[model samples]
Target: MLNRRHIRVKVMQSLYANLGGESEDFSKDQKFLMQSIYSMYDLYILLISIFIEVRNKGIDQIGKQKQKHLATKEDKNPNTKFVNNEILKFMGDNELILEKIKQQETIDWDLDSEYIDIIFKAIVSSNAYKSYMKTRMSNFQQDKEFITTVFREVIAPNDKLYDYIEDKNLTWLDDLPTINTTILKLLQKLRPNPTKTYLLPELYRDEDDLKFATDLFTKTLLNQNELNEEIKHKTINWDSERLASIDLVLIQMAICELKHFPSIPVKVTINEYLEIAKEYSTPKSSNFINGILDKLVKEYEADGKLNKVGRGLL
Candidate 1:
């Protein structure tokens, strides 16, 4: 699920796309932004399914090796540690995951078998895989740790998988960090259970979260003139032409939140955008944006325009 900062980043991207002339149609661009976010959740599911693919790859290799006419003893009795990893077994039997695969039809690794082959080969060669195979009678904690190491070492950094996923969906690159982190956390939280029902994260926490995304997108677009007027007055010393378009959009968003989002604290809004500016804008943008928004926030306060509600909301 996307937190407020992630949603803000999506809104910032949409605003930048429209303001940057990447796309002139605000409504269409906004729809693309929302879709981009939903696409991220799908990416998460697709990524989780990779573990199953990797396991299947392991199973397939063992079967072929066993059928070799002069197969070695190792081939005849291949280590089944990976195929039987508790976490993988649990996820394989997870009803929700199976249902979602049928429902979404978004995660098809069969067409891209080379990636599964590459990832499986990397795992088979790694010390983590070898060590797990040598361990005897592994518990759930051991199974969880091994898969996490395999994921962090092999799957997460595999160039082939990364390139393939990014090529398939451009939005995956932007979402990779958040989705990977969330999956890792979910993996960490798993414990042995007979119910076999693992909790998959939702796309949004609630309808309010959905509303927040569209509201920020819509309000920023609707109040662009007013927001820019506020920025223009505050940055009288700096030429708007000299400012980065990204910086302009971020500041405009911060202003929108300050005036329109009454429940959000002014300080929280300022800090959030400043942090976002660090990643998406220029190196000096955090402080540059900080100065303009600081002055405007003070001015907005003086004018009694910010009608914040709730305790400590103003």
Candidate 2:
């Protein structure tokens, strides 16, 4: 589910962490980089597991209400619509999902049942829940729509759940938005009955993307001296030490893509880094990096140094 730009962000972050010097343990850093990328899947699993836990909480509550000595007819035969939700049951019973959650061993909602309780309470109080409970009979379309609304409005935005995720893994905070987006998209496309493997998405789109992450990280680190020299003359007015570390790293990565990865177009490289800068660096970073890159691309083109290939790659 991860796209190329997201992979670039991951590479950029690792590069930023080791910006001051060559890492003493390059393999460890590489391992950490891949681990961090894969951990996004774990976060995805953790988020989806909330649905399963909430369903379980509902079942438990219904059982308790049935045993009440002063039970009304409503309590004895409560609306089981939320607990019997088709999508939730599908996720809860899917062997592949359950196995993956257990294998990761990082996310256990049973131990963190309080979060489940918190989300269940939020869901019960939601208008979506009220409208959904009005119908007792299960319909896939209604169940799916109700789930989408609850997830988007209630479960995903709860402050306690957010804090719990933050406390569990710092890197997960960045992945939360992306993972939530992935979940919503999946929910939208889900069939009334899907295969067991439907929810398990591959991390990288293909092997090439996997290679791109490693190559970008390694090439940028190894070509530091050459990349620095390229930036040196362009930024003559600015002290090298005074340059924003993030801007420098972004420039180096962009340059690496331009010269080393000849298949990628020059415009693509420049635009990608500039967007990343707008989001990650100083407010002026996009313009600043753009100016230096514009100058370098001009010089490289004039000197026939740009090795970009394919039509319109320049």
Candidate 3:
């Protein structure tokens, strides 16, 4: 599911792309924003579906091994531990996940199944898988733990999988971290007998998050000149041309939230943008953004311009 910081990052990416004169149509940019965010869900399903595919691959390998004319006793009766993983089986047949997967347009692992083979090989050869397969006995807890361990160690970090995802959709590169973390946490907390709908979380936490993403993108873009002026005033000592484009966009977004969103605390907005800058911008970007935002917040506080509401909002 999407979080606010991730939403902010999506909006920042959209703004960054659109601000460079790539498109003038506001609706198009907004459409791109929503589509890009929704694409995260597609990526989620795609990545999560890797488990099912890898398990199937294991099953097929076992079948082929049995079909061989000179099959060894081990191949004839191969260890099916990974193939019978309860967590993977649950995900494979979950109605909600199947429905979502059916609806996905951007993710077709069928075409790029080499990635599945890659993940399957990595998982089977891993220490976790070897240790798990050493025993024919496994409880649901052990099964879940094995899946989580391989996911965290193998599938999630595979360079080939990462490259395939990036090549599939550039936006996915940004969404990858959050989606991978979400999948990891979901696996970590998966119950022995989970419901059909357990894995299918709503993309936005609530409608408020959706509205916040919409409003943040719209207000920042529409009020760009004003936001630029506010930032310009704070950066009188710094050269405008030398400022990172991402830092400027982040500052503008923070200022937009400060002035336009009364319910969001000033401190929260500042911290969120600063954190984003640390991840996405120059090495000194967070410090630069923090300094400018700190000065602006103090000025806004004195002039009664922040208008932050609720207790402890200031």
Best by lDDT: 2
| Candidate 3 lDDT over residue span 1-314, tens digit each | 89999999999998988774322357988998999999998899998788878888988999999999999999898888778889988988787888888888866778888888888889878999889999877999999999989988998889998898888899899899899899989988998788888888789999999999989998888888778878888887766678889998999899999999999988889899989999999999999899898998899889988787799999
Query: Which of candidates 1 and 2 is the stronger one according to lDDT?
Result: 2
Lowest summed lDDT across 10 adjacent residues in model 1 is found at 20-29
lDDT of 2 by residue, 1-314 (tens): 89888888888888888786544456977887898899999999888878888898999999999999999999999999888999999989988898887887878776888888888999999999988888799689889999999999998899999999999999888788888988999998998778988888888889999999999998888878779888988986767788999999999999989889988999989999999999899999999999999999998899998998789999
| lDDT for each candidate structure | 0.83, 0.89, 0.88
- Among these predicted structures, which one has the highest TM-score? 2
Stretches of candidate 3 above 4 Å error?
20-25, 237-239
TM-score of 2: 0.96
C-alpha lDDT of residue 28 in model 1: 81
Segments of candidate 2 deviating more than 4 angstroms: 22-25
Clashes of each: 0, 0, 0
Q: Candidates 2 and 3: which is better by TM-score?
A: 2
